[model samples]
Target: MMLETGKIRENHKAALPYYYRMVIEVPEHFQALPGQFLQIQIESKTTDPLLRRPFSIAGLSRNRVTVFYQVKGKGTILLSRLQAGDSISLLGPLGKPYPAVPGPKIILAGGLGAAGLLFLAKNLSLGSQNKKSVVLLGCKTKEDLFLLDNFQDLGIPTYCATEDGSFGFKGLATSLLTQKIKKIPGKGTLYACGPNPMLAMAGKIAAKHGWSAYFSMETMMACGIGLCRGCAVATINGYRLACVDGPVFPAEEIIWGKLPPHPPLSPKGRGLK
Candidate 1:
């Protein structure tokens, strides 16, 4: 809950067309974890866009923080224009992170949603000798996919799916999950982050097989803190603020049917390709 000025070390278009990767040099005291996000002030001198934009943390190092985001609206379009050495305002490391779970784990990501899971995958790869972890990514087409090499470089098994049959699996990433879930030996954990529909479907699949699952929910937010109840998410226990309560919640707690319709992506939204 601190407002800090971080310098953009690197900001450029990523492998995916409309997506960009940004590396910020933060204060040495700054700390963040996977599943948490930062609220970035897109413009420093004007109030045209007004509110800050939220982006999940993709990577973290001693003095750096990285984020991957798509150019969806005016705010993101402005973000993509930022260059290295630009000073940016950040409010963050906010929201709860995914709980540490041992044993076999399956990570499901769709489109830009993969951005949030990259840090988690890195953590899982450490001392991963006995743990069986895999990443299933979905996107619209071959060109929509990014960060495959980063995941593969970690020595974690990674799979991809594209709706156009231009890549790994020919179908939704959820379909691939259905097939992979069958191969789990005992109880395993499912971690997912994607468009609302994809997450809803992944939750259902996890429940059907009696697997423990957690999901990172996405929504619009005016304030990155709990003061503004603008990011409320419907849960079995009533309403919860996505900013503080979670961007991550256990699968069984969410009331999927109550979630708003998934917003259509300009080109494509988060999910496996």
Candidate 2:
């Protein structure tokens, strides 16, 4: 489904102001994963944010592609007014990504889930060039911090939570992932994406210890690819298709409040068909 058909080469706002970011390009083998997402087409087809928004894919160069919005309503305030070359219309490197293993890892983001964890923390700090690899961001204040200095300039190792605690671990970055899940390294691995009560408290603390998590569901999409169905993500072995099977699953296959209800879609609505 990769069509990025790009244009808009720059657009910004972050450090809050309802968050925003653009930088499109598309074409050049267009490869973007890490909790994949894309599905623009801001308006037209009789306007009014007309269906097609789903962003996240927040950093990638060479041919570009970076869309990270959160202006929330009126289709992201009509996509923060759009600019730079304009054009726009994408589909995506779509769903299913985020799966890289090594040693120490943990990237849990909240609040526009740090724009799909800024290209998944720059692809795990450029494939473990090692900097102690860690990134846990949460926001409720402190300018709703975005990109924490671009994942600390790729050396990763970032942590910030705020709920009036004003900054760095005031509370709930899953409570510093319960003190760094007892010092990580159960072969470390727990990638999250945020909201849905912080992926249900990081899937209840990575299912009480047996780690290896990965949950990037922000749902509520509109054809980010998979012919729409308006973003549905219910697991328990019945419904799965968050923009094509997943916006990244496996936080123990998520079935948290006993989910159920999804199936049958056609007009790009019902949650990523």
Candidate 3:
């Protein structure tokens, strides 16, 4: 991993629900992959917040890296105020990336989880000539949904679920996944990223159908690297560090019930901001 200071080219609200996408100009020599994350210090020269914030690489182009985030806490609130030409420190391209397994891929995402997984879909598409993929997204309402247009731009069929029936399906997105799984010719791979509860439900569904699934676990992390074990997650093999070992792992490896239901890291009307 490398520590570099990138200039902020843009930091603007790109969708509904007040989500912001920040674009940074990284060194031309730097490279990253889908699912890889970076630890960013909202204020490069301050100890107020102390810790660096971890964010997934939402998109990358040449030397430009995009991070999708929301003004959730004091740190993010500070980050959101940054404008064009500002600079931020980045230590990244960390964590294990999603495997590039060949198959018809089905991506399951809840709320802003789409931020990271979108890069995975893009990489897989570029790497394989015929990697058919689809995305199923879930949110509380239509306004909570984001990235639908981006997915469609990639030619990947997108289905959505909103709790208030303000969108495509009436129930949870996992219900749509269940219906889709039945129509597949054979076992397909599932990649999911979202809140613990949604992922837990997705894991159970994938297991029930005998489909292989990889999950991106979301947790409060003190350190983006493994030096601090604050982000340890229970698995069948034992406790694994979400910062280094994962942030991504097979669905079967997770001990779902042991994880409590928690709200997403993004701003969701919580007092975090």
Candidate 4:
């Protein structure tokens, strides 16, 4: 819940063609955990793009937080044009973090989802003496991949899968996971962050193996806080706010089907709540 002005010390293209990395300099005491995110205002004074964009913290240093993003729209396009020495408003370290689960740990990442999971991998490797933790990365093609070396540098066994057979495994990332999880020996938890479809698949796989899992969901969020109610996600307990309740949730907590279409408005023009 801290709102601070951070200087953009670095904004450059990453290994992937479309992805870019931005490094912001924060105060000394501002600490952020893995799986938490920052809400950034692209422009300092203008009100044009009214909402701040949410980006998961990819990596953290002494006083710098790094975020990896793709220039998908006008806001991000504008963000890409900014150079070093610029300043942006950042609101962050929000939402609950991924749970610290025991036993052997596995991380599954899809596409750009690797950005956040990288932080999680780093934390787990440093905190544990057991070196069995592994990272599974999946992408559409080899060109779509990034950060492979970074993960390997951490001394964790990292595997990759590509849909086109242009990389490690010839099928979906889950295929790699399926083959690997069997060798884990005992009960283990999986932490995943990716597209809804991929998360759903991983959830199903985790269930099939009787393992607990957590998923980091991606959605359109307006306010970083719960005030906007813009990021509601359907759960068994009813709708939950993604910004506050989670960008991360237990895999079993969500109702994975496409939400039923809302009812039509009444003749008086009042819509269903």
TM-score per candidate, chains pooled: 0.95, 0.33, 0.95, 0.92
Worst 10 residues of 4 by lDDT: 264-273
Query: Largest TM-score belongs to which candidate?
Result: 1
Candidate number with greatest lDDT:
1
Between candidates 3 and 4, the TM-score winner: 3
Backbone collision tally, model 1: 13
Candidate 2, residue 68: Cα displacement in angstroms equals 2.5
Candidate 4's residue-wise lDDT over 84-158, tens digit each? 999889998888778888888789998888998988888887877338688999988887677788788888899
Off by over 4 Å in 1: 129-131, 267-273
On the 0 to 100 scale, the lDDT of residue 206 in model 2 is 73
Better of 2 and 4 by TM-score: 4
Stretches of candidate 2 off by over 4 Å are: 16-20, 23-35, 38-66, 69-83, 86-91, 97-108, 116-141, 146-160, 167-169, 176-201, 206-214, 217-247, 253-273
Cα lDDT computed for each candidate against the true fold: 0.89, 0.74, 0.84, 0.84
Q: What is the lDDT of residue 222 in candidate 2?
A: 64
Model 3 residue pairs with clashes:
none
